[model samples]
Target: MSDQTTQRHPNILFILADNLGYGELGVYGGGPLRGAPTPHIDGLAAEGLRLTNMNMEPQCTPSRSSMLTGRHAIRSGTYAVPLGGVPEGLTQWEITLPKLLSDAGYATALYGKWHLGRDDGRLPNDQGFDEWYGIPRTTHETTWLTSPGYAPELVRPQHIMEGRKGEPSRELQVYDMQERRVIDAEITRRTVAFMEERARGHQPFYLFTSLTQPHFPTLPHPRFAGSTGKGDWADMLAEMDHNVGEMLAAIDRLGLRENTIVIFTSDNGAEFIKPWEGWAGPWRGAYFTALEGGLRVPFILRWPGQVPPGLTSDELVHGVDLFTTLATIAGVAIPQDRPIDGVNQCDLFQGTSAKSGRDGLLVWVDNRLQAVKWRNFKAHFYQQDTMMSPPEKLPVPFIIDLYTNPREEEGKRASGWVLEPMLKMVQAFEASLVEHPAIPMGTPDPYEPPRRCP
Candidate 1:
């Protein structure tokens, strides 16, 4: 924002919404249309920079891993959400964003879902967060308690857990349907308290408030149930907005608005499951697919005096970019020992340049190269319209110009010229893999990447 402001690290409050669709927000053209009015979230867009073409990995674990590590999930061995019973998550060798920030003397905490890992040494506290309090896995696990034929003795129930760095994470309670409904509220409350406490100190803080809402079993809090008059979906959406507004109000009340960077985004596109499905705005497909609907999600950043207000950019931005961008903003140096896929987007965020400093990225769905996006065009090697549908591997990669066909329905008619750049992008990534190599899935700790000399 200002030269003085740039001298000191600013507090970062990143609020991640699980399975929030692009068009679900009013600013993105789905609020009222979707029977949910997001006044506070809409106001966030007006107050800061919004990216229309923000992209993420097709699934929760991959997207979150990419964001935290600044590397593709394939490289981190978190390419997919593990069903359970495995040593899954980032290796201890991986330098996470919170770890980086914490190393720089910031108070770091995550007050929601920490799906990266569920066991010791891999939990949020062990991964650089000073403290963490949330579920070990997804919100849908809460359904396991109510689902028929579920045997608790066979599969240990998911718990609402908490931990401090250098300590074993302790289970707090069962994350059941009731806990699911009120978890977001608890996350918000802790987040607000974290901000208030950190504001009193000289050290800046990095608080990641991961709200588990509108995902599966999209239950609204008791206070918000029937508040929307539409259904549980609409009510949950309203609750999400209200929770956001509460945090924004806290920032203002504590006078941290000018010195804090507030970010709002989703883990993926939208939920595709029945009875709890989410709209992807104007796009087709949903999470777990390579289509725009699955890869593209809503992204809003509010840095009062630094980032330009009411600015919407269609230039490509990915969830991985958050790691590099925030590192730059906090004056932290990223690791150079490994390949980092995220590009520095400081200029784009500050509105200093129109380009996003990135032109394309490889699209992966569970360790498989599903597609490649370059500029406004994408080449899909596999087609899976929705999460429920089986992916069809095509003999020839289908291409689509997103500007003309956002729905990707006329991919057969796409120009052949786009194939060159798309393939080149894919080839470049594959080449990088040959040198640095991707970490194999379920890689154990005490890992060390091979070193190659020029």
Candidate 2:
């Protein structure tokens, strides 16, 4: 095929949900919940591939960083939430997905939350996204709810913004947390407009519509309020589902569905909020913990003819893999020198392979190495002193069977568990960690402590 014909790449649309879980959607067997149905998300799964064993970092920033850079979060030096401002954002050495796609003549834009970095040097414009409109920091808590008497300083700020189309300026706008009705609607409107504009343009585009709904403060638009019949959190999820439907509708109307690859996933698992049933379905624990519910997130990929409709795969994949897979689909070359922790799972999506493509996986939480999954077995490692101790000197590692027990329990043990593979994977992962140790917690480093606004 000629360069022009090869360059006629499929438009990529990645929709990310903050703190969404695997069992939250109807297609994931959450249909019996009292919430408003998620027909649109279910439709996407029915039309594409639903990955049953998708994993992410324990927190949002790290997971998103892994996705953007195709490397471990520690390698990017974005280990945890920023303290005050992001100094070392995504390393310039890292080749981001947008950068690769843009180089291949694809226009890229990010709408909604951007928790990766906040400083001008770390903004999306600096990190390969041609256009960005969302929170500079990780969450809205840093800007809106960080005040003394507001919610406990337990979470990061989750703000909102729009970039590349305004007056070449950046500013923060505050809104009532209870009144997300207006905010979400406006974001959807702007995102749809962006899609329509890109569809009319000469080049194919890659757009990331990151939603802040269903995160925390679990507030839904008034029109969707009580629509879920469950509670506040379910209502927020319903609103998020509606926004997704609107985006899909726009793609169909613009005559781009056939040539577009749409993916929907969450940064991590659910967080603490009312409607305890609103979050991760049938799984134990919420965010900030090293539980299956916290890391195993919802992953849906849709590519009309390329991906068989009504298909589900139990392959173990990570958010970071999307970078290489999309690059491969676009015929872009991924740099070989850098350390990228993701693989191209195009064959798995095609249903030709049952292999996970990954022999081992790593996860971090609050700047500490929390867990490692090797096939059916997983090991959990916790740091005694996150602020002072080196990761290698932390202590003995605990092992568990993810296939039998999703939760790491105290008394449960896998008898004569295959230690050779687990030990080898752990040594490899630890060797990589020594080269890039976990940033000590509670430090001035951007990846150590959670972002705190004064």
Candidate 3:
């Protein structure tokens, strides 16, 4: 690792959208065609690199945990979203990205939805952030207060929370539909303020501005409710575009554009809910499934002079790869005690290399090995049509050439040889579990990895 004092580490502004799909932004394919224009986000891509084949976990909790820990969500006990008050999230033992950056002398703050945990020891501040403000769980709870036959004692109303490190989170207000409409704007405002303050102090900061937009029950701010005139969904898209523009403008205004790395991506593919559901462009299925639509999402990164502008790559990069990639960029050492699934992709991001460090990644949905994506080929051990349907366990691995079947539909068969590499990747991963067993879902705190034999 480089000396922190000698090398001024670049600031990281990671803006994550909830349930945003690959085709949602204009650069990849949708924007105006989807009835809302994303000029601001598109401009960001025009000034940076746009990744077409970026893959994430099938759901929010899994993807987020994977990225932060640089390990598979299954290894960290967060393979799926916690439901029915299940206490599922990252254990205290996991080494998160924000924690690493903080140790490297970077100030950290998280604004927006944090689906990682709802308990004291599992929250953002507890993990690594210096200060944080966001919902402790998913936005789906915002509707719980209004649902028919709702009972407060059964499931308490979700609240907007704020906290600093070493302090309990302060519950602000009930996060209802009205509050949901305005919360994103607040996140952006606080993020901009944090950027300004850190820039003034001449400190490198890692700002995880996680936005809760275009998720289920998608609603735009009151001011933008009807701005698009296409519908509420389009209106929400327009609002998100404007908010992202504000953040970009702030970086430029603070004169931090040249030194800050601005990233825009999502935790999942798209919403599986109806009416408020999002478009995955050309892919099939939705969030919570093993299909391409569930695994692929939009990813854009901008770093003036350092990262080449207006370049696009189809290189396969997993969401967990960001951990090692950013840690390398920030001059931090990745922990060697655990199996880190993320590989360094700094060269790929800087345009010096056309190939990603990883050629394949195992796809886990609900703690089960559902699929394996090796280069442009994919082999599925389980098949799921949508989030609402039951998964079918196949006796034989089903193979598809993603180049010809981006939709993963029946057509353009892949050679049987593709299975050999896929099998090798899966076998190596399973063998690793023998030494470092995966933490079971809902594992309590004060957790420790099982002892490895010499």
Candidate 4:
């Protein structure tokens, strides 16, 4: 190999949790949930960098889209869960993170839940992933393990399939909705197999291990079922942590640990209802709304020599920022024509910079503008008076101070933070809304509303 090729390009192991909170893990002071500890995850944090101000979309699909596209979820055409795939889907025009890295000679594979799109063309394969396994959509109907055989009532529609280069696609109903377990061992085994395969190859790889764990209808394997002191939720979390430990162990066994960059974060905050007795730390509320508990999540990144170990950073960061950061680390050029919301913050992770490249970030839920994070201030807006109300009232918009309000623990009282700058930013965003209207509320219509969901 040439000198350039001999200089190892960092491998990426990105793990995303479904609904995790900032305070749930040991490193984050989550405390023992029923006596079980996230030692693996905490160890990773202790040996890597822990981001204290990491933010994400309030829901799963949007956040997933943001992570892949490096753009705000609104730009991805997935404002909310599409009932009939209306307003088009995540357009092919956008270059995804995996696709970008793949183009630059990285082998990309996405394992576990891919809730971004359901159509094959819109699936991970079409979006630059070299290999894909797991559910393509977020529906309670499909089980991850025993699908197509044990037909059970599905709570929603989901696509479960596996694909590789030049291989005929295999569709299976492996998921068991009622049981709430995706045959844990199978998923872990496949992941291990992938890791082993990649270890034998010379090419750098980007593997997105998107586990469907700690989500609703929580189910931990028999071994982990009463392991945690918190209950089933804690048990499920412990199981998820165990899977992570397995993956990390594979990296060590394959001697890929030093050269690989392992990033662990959640898609969003915990759900409204705690699934496995999971706590959002001090944050209040759960998924589906613009609350601290809904967006602020635990973020840990480990790259032996590249990232400083055992460092904690409170600088603001977002899931969208991962694309540019990875691109910068890989020394790849990002296209300048399209708007990329993410900024390369590798320095921030290294503990050399306290400044966040972003001045502000707009948070969207179900395609509607729900919150804005400007510096230390975060303004959370709601459409209707109710927490889960429709997007109509959101058009008016409002503001809140996240640092002072934190998780809205104070109830209706304001944190006394000024709203002028936030209002200005919201106005600018609203003006931009002219070009990209919110997905119309209510049922389907020939005449769509001016505002669209993000």
Minimum summed lDDT over a 10-residue window in model 2 is located at: 441-450
- The C-alpha lDDT values of all candidates are 0.90, 0.73, 0.90, 0.73
Per-residue lDDT for 75-135 in model 4, tens only? 6566565555353346666678888888888888988888766655567787788888887
Which stretches of model 4 miss by more than 4 angstroms? 1-8, 85-89, 142-159, 165-168, 178-184, 274-277, 383-400, 409-418, 427-454
Whole-structure CA lDDT of model 4: 0.73
Model 1: ten consecutive residues of lowest lDDT:
1-10
- Candidate 3, residues 1-454: lDDT per residue as tens digits? 2335424799999999999887888877888877799999999999999998899998999999999989999888899888845666888999999999999889999999998888888889999999999899878788888889999997789889999999988999989988999999999999999999987788889999999998888989999998978998889889999999999999999988888999999998988897888888899988998898888899999999988999899999999999999999988999999899999999999999999999999999888899999999998888788888888999888899887888887666678898988889988998888888999888888889877667
What local lDDT does model 4 show for residue 24? 78
lDDT of 2 by residue, 1-454 (tens): 2335524698898998888877888888775473667899999999999988888886778888889878878766777766653264565556799889888888888877787666565677766778887766544463366466666356434445555622342765644454344566766787788778876664688888888776666677888888867777678778888899998999899888888899999888766555433456766666666667877888999998889998887667887898888898988899885557889988898777868678777777765667777777767776322223344532656677776776566567675465567667667867765554544322233333233355
Clash count, predicted structure 3: 0
* Candidates, ranked, TM-score: 3, 1, 2, 4
Q: Estimate each model's TM-score.
A: 0.97, 0.86, 0.97, 0.86
Q: What does the lDDT come to for candidate 3?
A: 0.90
Query: Residue 100 error for model 3, in Å?
Result: 0.6
Predicted structure 1: lDDT: 0.90
Better of 1 and 4 by lDDT: 1
* Model 1 C-alpha lDDT per residue in residues 152-173, reported as the tens digit of each score: 9978899999999999999999
Better by TM-score, candidate 2 or 1:
1
Better of 3 and 4 by lDDT: 3
